[model samples]
Target: MKANDLNKWLVQERARLIDNYLNLIQKCLGGTIYEDPPLQALGSDKFDPVLREYGWDWPSMAHTMIGQKRLGNIRQLVESVLGNGIEGDFIETGVWRGGACILMRAILDAYHITDRCVWLADSFEGLPPPNEEMYPADAGDNFHTFNDLRISLETVQHNFQKYGLWDQQVRVLKGWFKDTLPNAPIDKLAILRLDGDMYESTWDALNALYNKVSIGGYVIVDDYHVVQGCKLAVQTFLAEKRLSPVLQEIDGVGVYWQVANGTSSS
Candidate 1:
């Protein structure tokens, strides 16, 4: 096989192996697996929300919760920005099992791009307990108590390794967003994915990184519609910054938009 063909085959094979592993784990954990015909027919959506979220009720694995539609959008955004000569790295602020960020690295690896980086920014200790005194909306919601939602940095690195995509170009930022994001060493960003499911987490990411996102870059919100606090934070940030980019829905819960040139707070 030609060099390009060889690379393509390897990428596909690695992906298949990982999928099999995930399926095996699901079954081992007594989780029922169901296929969605509509999504399968469309060949877009990957994980069924009903199965992954409720049916499984298991820990968040090193798999995508954003589904196929959102995942495709991430790949397209990366391709578009790179093809258009846009410069910078890709970052996901609230990486779960690091699936989305791994996908970013995989895209770059497959295309032989070495200049850009993929950043996995997360607490790695699960969500912080809501500061009810300040963010009343999160009051009584103990997301931090969900041990399954928290995955360590080591496991995330292992997840990347499973796909043969682990490398120095993949950076991990560990800490709460408020403490870590403001001083993150990211020079610029081509794709900013925020899966931070709360007002404070979402707001901090935007405050620290939105301006650094290059013109025409994509900002994807993974929980914008499903989380009230997250939705409000996005709206408030956009309004405060006077950014008018159209928010396009990626699925039932996720949304994204391209950053227009000169869009930022003074």
Candidate 2:
């Protein structure tokens, strides 16, 4: 075979391997491995397509709960950055089980890209109580009461280890975004994904990290449409900064945009 053919074959083989690996990761994280059992029920049965697709239902043992849409979005965006030569690292503010970040690491490994890092920023104690006085948009928010949101840091680390993706390249900021993000050592970001589900969390993540995202980087608002406070915070931040990046929806509830220099919109 010619050198060009050998290179072509290698590229195809790499893509196949990465595709299969990512598919397995998606299945494992989405709990499709268990055939999507009913978490609340004592017995296993058929899965709910609608709930799983929209991430409305909880997973019994899955690593991620963002469902197929958001999970796939992370992979696509990460691959996009790598393909477009977008600079910097990847980060998620409210990584539930570290599944999304795991996928990011997996992609980097697949492409043999060693320069980028995967940053996981979460309190690991779940959402904080709504500071209603300061953030009226978060008034009456009960996300704090959701016991499932409080996955510990050790468990998250173990999750990354389980996938063989845990390494120095995966950095964990183990505190609330407001406290940790402001002083985060991350120099720049290519993908800044915000999964925090409240006004305060969203606002804090954006306030601390948005400016650090490279001009060509992406901003993924995980709960933009599903969580009103989250949406309000995003809009407020955009308005304040006069940013007008074109917004694109993912599965109705999630949305993202790529940063550009000095955009303005009313």
Candidate 3:
């Protein structure tokens, strides 16, 4: 087989393995494995008044499984780390429509965690030009250009407001990862979600925030499994830093890292 054919086969095999693993986990857990709800479900016209009050019109369960899984896992990890006295904020580097951030905020409210903030960072514009060294050859033009589906900072802020999260706890940073990450006022993070679809964005996020990730915190990579370039960047960075933590598979599309106490800043 040609190299390209072999690569395709490999991807298929990995996906199959991930799917099987998730099936087993779900069966064992014995709960309704929810797909993300449709975006319209949260709308005032579609949802009941009670559900609408909770910001229910978001992506369907299947659409946001990776994010939901990451959030669930991170919440468990953070609870374990801090026990009943957790004291750190949540952060997401690439928020689109603010769905995941809203979920995080909602979860915090449900758990009565009002002390911590949820930092939402994004350029609102889409992916940056691919760096040949950082991105794989097959990534193509999957991301939106700034003009294609121009999502602005104001738009995402409106999303938060729609979800009843427009409080002082939600901070929106408007700029590229490199430009905005360094200036973020975060000192220690309990959960850091990286959803940037490109290598430079992912790398910049990791560089700026990984060290600050509290021991026993969680770092979620939203595009790691679906995008080879993203997976490559994360794996390469982990290897170079000599940090080895448990790699958890989420929804066959994303991978998360549990940042244990042994995780190195080096």
Candidate 4:
């Protein structure tokens, strides 16, 4: 489908599909555990709009904070890259249950984009605990200990297969972002998505891969509004690099910016 047309269709269908999927999952599983007990205590009514809008208040079927609105935002970004003929592969630096990454690959398949691949980067062990000595902004973070957030590489691959989207075009960079991103053989990126929740992980990803993003491409920060540490890391990194792209909001917690340098993707 044409990009404009697909965007329109997505605007109408994305929410319906997500609601149906969530309902199906709830029916199959009976119930899901709350990863954050504090939020559970508050119940959905008491949840903040920022949290409620992005599916954070929903029962955890997956660690995906992205819901229908954010997913539509991502689809638009990825589609813009393809529609504009940007030259680079698509990459998500902090895949959890691989839902977002799967969506990336699915778009490629739908658009018949054969040259560009989707790279799934993650520790497959949830997040890494904060390194307070080096990244002080993440001092009190304990997100790494949440076992519910950790999905194994095998399970992620299985999720991909379940959608019948598993193939060579899907690559996994399985390890902590700090350990895996720097030397990963990625040639270029048309869409570099950052979901790393802490200061260290978010900082490391931009430090290692931001330079490789094509000028017309996009860099999406998933935890930007939700995680203060992630926001700080992004602001600091962009300042140090003397790069200033307008940050655009996506639903509640997610935000993204297009690389605006004069450099060409060709």
For each candidate, give its TM-score against the true structure: 0.78, 0.94, 0.68, 0.80
Per-residue alpha-carbon lDDT of candidate 1 for residues 125-208, written as tens digits (9 for 90 to 100): 999999888877777776788675688999888878877889989998899999999999999999999999888899989999
Ranking by lDDT: 2, 4, 1, 3
All candidates in order of TM-score, best leading: 2, 4, 1, 3
lDDT of 3: 0.64
Go through the candidates in order and give the clash count of each.
0, 0, 10, 0
How high is the lDDT of residue 129 in model 2?
Answer: 96
Name the better of 3 and 4 by TM-score: 4
lDDT of 2 by residue, 76-180 (tens): 989888999988999999998888898889888888888999999999999999999999999999889878789999999999999899998899899988899
What's the CA error at residue 257 for candidate 3, in Å? 2.0
lDDT of 3 by residue, 1-266 (tens): 99999999998986587445444333222112432234442243332322322223333322222333554554455555446454578898887666567666655654466788889888888666665654554356456543433467787777667546678888878888889998788888888889887767788898888888876677888777766767777877888888876777765666677676667331
Worst 10 residues of 3 by lDDT: 27-36
Error of 3 at 203 (Å): 0.9
TM-score of 2: 0.94
User: How much lDDT does each candidate structure score?
Assistant: 0.76, 0.88, 0.64, 0.76
Shift of residue 13 alpha carbon in model 2, Å: 1.4
The alpha-carbon deviation from the true structure for residue 254 of candidate 2, after best TM-score superposition, in angstroms, is 0.2
